[model samples]
Every structure is written in C-alpha cells, then in structure tokens.
Target: MSALLELRNVSRSFGGIHAIRNVSLTLQPGQIVGLIGPNGAGKSTLVNIITGVHPATSGTIVHKGERIDRLKPFQISARGIARTFQVVQPFPSMTVIQNVMAGAMFAANIRSMDEARSVAMEHLTFTGLAAMADRPAEQLTLANRKRLELAKSLAMNPHILMLDEVNAGLNTSEVEQALDLIRAIAARGISIVIIEHLLKVVTGLCSRIIVLHHGELIADDPAADVIKDPRVIEAYLGSKFAQRQMVRHG
Candidate 1:
C-alpha cells in the first residue's frame, strides 16, 4: 500500500533551537504507527508541520501524492488529514452533537448541513458518544472528552488520523477504553499516527513505532524492536524502560 501521508526531510527551528531536524515518516492506509519520545522531543513540532499548524523551515509534506507543505490548516484538513490535540478544545457551550457538527461542516463544504449532521451523528455513535449527544461538551468527564475528541476528528471523515497523547490522565480502565477506541478507529480503515509517551498503548496498538529524542529520530522499527532499542532506551525512558523490560520477563 502507498503512503497516505509522507514527510520528506522535514525540519523546523525556533529561536535557533532545532525543534525537529530532517524528520521523515509515512502512514499507509489502515495502519497504526506510533511516535514516542521523552518531553520536548519534537513530536508535536513534527505533528504541527504535517498538519500545517506550524510551517516547516525546510522540506516537504505530501499527502495522497500531492504536495501540501504550503496548505493552510483548514486546507490540510480538507485534504483528508485530521488530528486531535493533546489538550482538547470542544465548543464547551455546544451540545455534544453540536461540537461534532463542526467536524460535519468539513463534509458540508461539499455537501449539506443535513447530510453533515447525519454523518456526524454516525461518527458520534461510532465513537460511543451517542448517548451523550444532548449534553454540553463541558459536562463530560476526561475519558469522555477524549472520546469526544476522537469523535470530532472522525467527524471530518479523515483518511489519516493524527492523535496527540490521547491517553494522558486516565485510570487503567479509561486507558483501556481509549486503547479499544483507537483499535476500533483503525478497524474502520483510517490510518493513524499516535504520538504518546504511554508505552503500553504504543506496544499494544502500533505495529510500528518510531522513537525520537532531542528532535532526531533515533529508532524506527517494528514496535518490539523500537521498544528494545538501546539508544532509544538511553534517550527517552532512561533506565526505567529497560528496567520495566526486566520486570516484565523477570
């Protein structure tokens, strides 16, 4: 399968500090790829560059064989790319259904509001938000907020779903819910790039994982290999990632 999203030699800098340096990755249809690293690892920077939230200082972004490096954020969204923020921002005043209506609007540009609502409704139902459709976004718990974010992104009908730390502050059960939700999302045929520090999620969901440290990709391999990479070990998780390894087997 061909890549639905591709980054070629992409680099960005802020205040003379290289945030991301010559980073490149690909997402194929129906695949789940993980981006994992320590804090300030340029994961978000790369995500911003791809989603057009931050322009690349150099290099190219290609989606569906078309160059989209110069596209604006909305343009990028329109081109079959959608993302969830590490911090979700729902239209708090709006009902759950209404917040989803915003994503439905993406399809509405080429369709109709009625059609969009119908579609958005389906996404909400798919993401387990149907029962709360009448509730305000602000009224949701953290896990539901994460689910709502997933619903919102899905509402755009994106072919590629980019999730930024969707499992940050939840209980074990909540995290499992998130993990299951992501599996269902990918099962629905959307490719995904999950940027997470949660090793369990990465190991569980992604077939492949990329490790980055200090703005550089230090490891890109099968999820298993990436987890065991010594350089990756020293770079991000310190002695703990490896120690965890020993405990898992020992």
Candidate 2:
C-alpha cells in the first residue's frame, strides 16, 4: 500500500545553511512515528517543509500519492494535513470552544456557525476540554492550552497530524494524559509524526523512530532498535543515557 505521506530526498536550505538535507521518510495510516534529534537537527525545518510553511529546497513531497511540494500551506492543510506548532498560540479574545470553532470554519466543509460549533465541541470533548469550553483561551494553563491546540488541529480533520513538541512544558501527569490522547487519536486512524526530545516518551508511544543529525537522517527503524543505535547515542542521546535505557529495558 502507498504511504499516506512520503518525502523523497526533501531538503530545505537558508542561504548557505542546509537545515534539512535530502531527508526521506514515509508515514503510514494510523502509525505513530517519532522524529528525534538534538537541537539544530532540522526536525522543525522538516515539519515546516511538510506542512508547506516552507517549500522544499530540493526533491519531492507526496501526500496520499499526490505530489504536494509546490502547494501553499493552506492548500496542503485542506488536503487533510495539519500540524501544531512548538508554541501554542490560542486566540486570546476567543472562548476555548470558539477557538476550536475557528479551525472548523477554516476547513473546506463545516460552513455554518452552528455546524462549526458542534464540530468544535466534539473535538473539545475528545481532547478533554469540554468542561472548560467557556473559558477565555488566554486564561488556560500551559497544559490546557496544548490540549486546545490539539483540539483545534483535530477540528481540521487531518489524515496526518504532525505535532511539534506537544509534550513540552507539560507536567508528568499531563504528559501521560497527552500520551493517552495521542494514542486515542491514532486508534481513530490518524497517522501521527511526533517531534520530541523526550526519548522515553517517544519510545513508549512511537512504533517507529527516525533520528536526524545535523539535518541528515541517520537512522530510521523500529523504536526499540533506533534507541539502541550507537550513532543515535553518539549524536543525540549520550552513551550513558543509552546504557541506562538498555539496562532498564533489557
């Protein structure tokens, strides 16, 4: 079967700097994949390229068997690809539910205000934000705001969802809750690409893991093996960290 999203030799550069160099990967339906690397590894750059926030400097991007490299950001999103930023920026003036409604309104379908609101409520409930739906978005705590971001993206009804550090700044319990939410999303048939620094979290939730080093993909394999790869340890996670992981999981 064809991949839901495929990047073939995709690269993005700024002036003389190559943020991503010929990185290729595929995301299959309902699969949860992790993108892991140290800072400056071009993880966010790759996500930006896929979401059409930045065009690829070279090579191709195929979504559901259709080439999408040249498409605009909104166009790519309309095709059922949605992403959340590292920073959650909810509309401060809007109520929590209204913020989600905005995403539904922006989609090709869900035209009426009532329809948007209904869709918004469904997502809010899914993300555990139903009770707080009336609160001002700005008033939400960091963890709740992250949930809001997830809810808004879900309202867009994406087939492939790319989350950039969705677990960042979340507490231990919140992180566990977020993991459960992500699992539920995948259970519903959404393919997910999670860019995360937390190795334990990635290993726990992602079936496959892709590691990038200085803009190049160094390893792409099952999460279990990828974590133990020597190159991955030397480049991103230190050898000691890898040793600890081995001892714990062995």
Candidate 3:
C-alpha cells in the first residue's frame, strides 16, 4: 500500500521549548495505526501540525504527493484529511444530525445543502447515532458525544482520518463500541491514525502501533511487539503493567 500521508523530520516548538522533535512517520491506505505515549509526549502536537491547527517548526508534510504543511485547517479538510479533537466539539444548540452536517459543509463530494444533509444522516447512522439524530448535541451522554464527534469527522469525506484519544474516558463497553466504529471506518478503506491511552483499544483495533516519548518516536511495529518493547515498557508502560502484560503473553 502506498502512503497516503507522510511526515518527514517534522518538528514543532512553543516559543523556545520543543514539543515534537524530528519525527517521521508514514500512514498507508487502509491501515489502522496506534500512537501511544504519556502526557506531553507530543501526540496532540503532532496531530495539530498534521491537521493544520499548529504550524510545524520545521518539516515537510506530504499528502498525495503534494506538500500540505502550510494549509489552513479548513484547507486541510478540503484536501480530504479529517481529524476529531481529543475533546469532543459539538454545537450545543444544534441537533446531533445538524452537528454532523456542519462538517459535511466542507466535503468536496456533496454538492448541495440537501446532499450534505443526506450524507450527514448516513454518517450518523454509521456511527450508531441515528436514534439520537434529533437530540441536542450537548444532551448526549459522553460516549455518544464521542460517537457524534466521529460521525462529524466521517461526514467530511476523508481519505485520512485522524482521531485524538477518541476512547479516553470511556467505559469498557463504550470503548468497544468506539472501536467497532473505527473498524467500520477502516473497512470502508479509510486510513486512520489513532492517538489513544487505552492499550486494549489500541491493541484490539490497530494493525500497527507507534510509541512516542520525550517528543520522539521510539517504536513503530506490530501492536503486540510494540507493547513488548523494553523501552516502551520503561518509558510509558509501567513496570507492573508490563509484568501483567507478560503474564498474559505467556
């Protein structure tokens, strides 16, 4: 599979402090990648840079053989890259469908308002939000709120979908539901880069896992192997958890 997105030697900084350091990664079509790291590991910073919410200090972002490092967020969206925030963003006053329709407004495929709405409705259904279609966006429970956020991103007709901790704070069953949504998306041939803290969600849903620490990538491999890396264990996965993981492996 060819790379749909590539970040080469990407680096980001805030004032004088470095947030991301010479990071390079490739995402291929239909691949589900897990990015796991401790807080301040530059996971969000990398997402922001890729999605155009934050400009890179220095690097090249290549998408479909074109440079896109400098595009605005909406411009990036127009280029077929859609990302969901770690914190869900829903228009509180709008209905669930309306919230998704807002994202469809940027879609290049749907030509008219009616077309956008139709597509948005389909995406809400895909994410299991059809029953709550008329509910106020803010009225949904936390799990559904995350599902709404995923639906909104899906409505954008993305070639590459970036999710930022979409499973964080969810109960086990809710996380399973969220994982199912992600699997459905991947099955439709969308490349996904998921930044998550839940190891189970990552190991279960992603084909590969990438580990980050101190703003640099330390491991990128199959999900099972990455979890077993000693560096990943010491730096991010604690000793006790690693012990339990080993026991399960054996």
lDDT of each: 0.87, 0.93, 0.90
Model 2 Cα displacement at 122 (Å)? 0.5
lDDT of 2 by residue, 1-250 (tens): 7788889999999999999999988888889999999999999999999989999999999987899999999899899999999999999999999999999888647889999989999999999999999999999999999999999999998989999999999989999999999999999999999999998999999999999999999999998899778899899999888789779879
* Candidate numbers, best lDDT first, in rank order: 2, 3, 1
Sort by TM-score, best first: what order?
A: 2, 3, 1
lDDT against true structure, model 2: 0.93
For candidate 1, list the clashing residue pairs, or say none: none
Top of the candidates by TM-score: 2
lDDT tens readout by residue for model 3, 187-213: 999999999988878898889998889
- Estimated TM-score for each candidate: 0.94, 0.96, 0.95
Residues 1-250, candidate 1, lDDT per residue (tens digit)?
7778888999998988999999888777898999999899999888888999999999998898999999999999987789999998899999998888888786436367687778778988988889999999999998899899998888887888999999988899989988988999899898999998888789989999988889998988998888778898888767976898879878
Comparing 1 with 2 on lDDT, the higher-scoring candidate is 2
**Clashes per candidate, residues 3 or more apart or on different chains:** 0, 0, 0
